[model samples]
Target: VNQNEHTPTGTIREFVALSVRSINFVMNAFAWIIALALLALALYLLYRWGTANYDYFEQRRVPYVLPFSAYGRMLTGRLHPVDAAGEGYRVFPEERFSGFFVFRQPGYLIHDPELIKQITIKDFDHFVDHSFNISPELDPFLGRSLFFES
Candidate 1:
């Protein structure tokens, strides 16, 4: 039953199997390459999104504090709200306000209490909503809370 037979059909079958495996390997390698490219593109887009508001103040012709990546100036602002506000305030102390980035969001920091009072009180109608509204679907409690509601 164990005859040493060098059949041409057996050789062709082995060659076909090897060819299929080679093709599969090449296809897998190409798929991996495409996946890596997409991952890199996603990461780059995320980085841009995180830093997109970095130049808002510059374009608006308002003085602004230098920002850090991803978290913007918010990282420092969160830790030291008064000091951070003062830093932006001093940048253009003579002016009424200066810009600061709360993460990717841009907002003006008023240096004078009178200006703040005018904006918050006298002109309250125009700017009724103080807190930024988040998605209720994403965070049910905080997003729909009275504190966030206008």
Candidate 2:
């Protein structure tokens, strides 16, 4: 009863259906491609951010060893604390202090014993708050103590 084999306008109907399916497939692929591109961009930005502030010592003309990762030669640079201290001390013997990082935080290894004693004793009041504890979340007893307050 129909003009076409399947229906009255089966040729046009089949063509439209095929076009719609093709368009849908293309759209999905395009979306996936855009998503992947965005993910790559985000990762690139993170890497830049991590290493961005690494040259802090360089800007100030302070002596420093190249950072291992974003931590700036912290635990990763040496196996032991003493070894790490020795390395920093040996690098710039002429300099009074050497710059180091404890995960992006700048620190100094005072090579001079006199300076250390002076800072510890002469300026004890300036460094009264030695504790870096914040809240009693981990070690309930020790963290709760007033002596541990930063």
Query: For every model shown, what is its TM-score relative to the native structure?
Result: 0.61, 0.61
- Model 2, span 1-150: residue lDDT tens: 645467647867889999999999999999999999999999999888877777899999888856573234344663565566456777788887788766556666788888888887787668665537766788788777644755
Scored by lDDT, model 1 comes in at 0.76
- Please estimate how well model 2 matches the true structure, expressed as its whole-model Cα lDDT: 0.73
Candidate 1 lDDT, 3-97, residue by residue in tens: 46758887888899999999999999999999999999999999998888788888889878776632444564554655665677656778888
Per-model clash counts, in order, read 0, 0
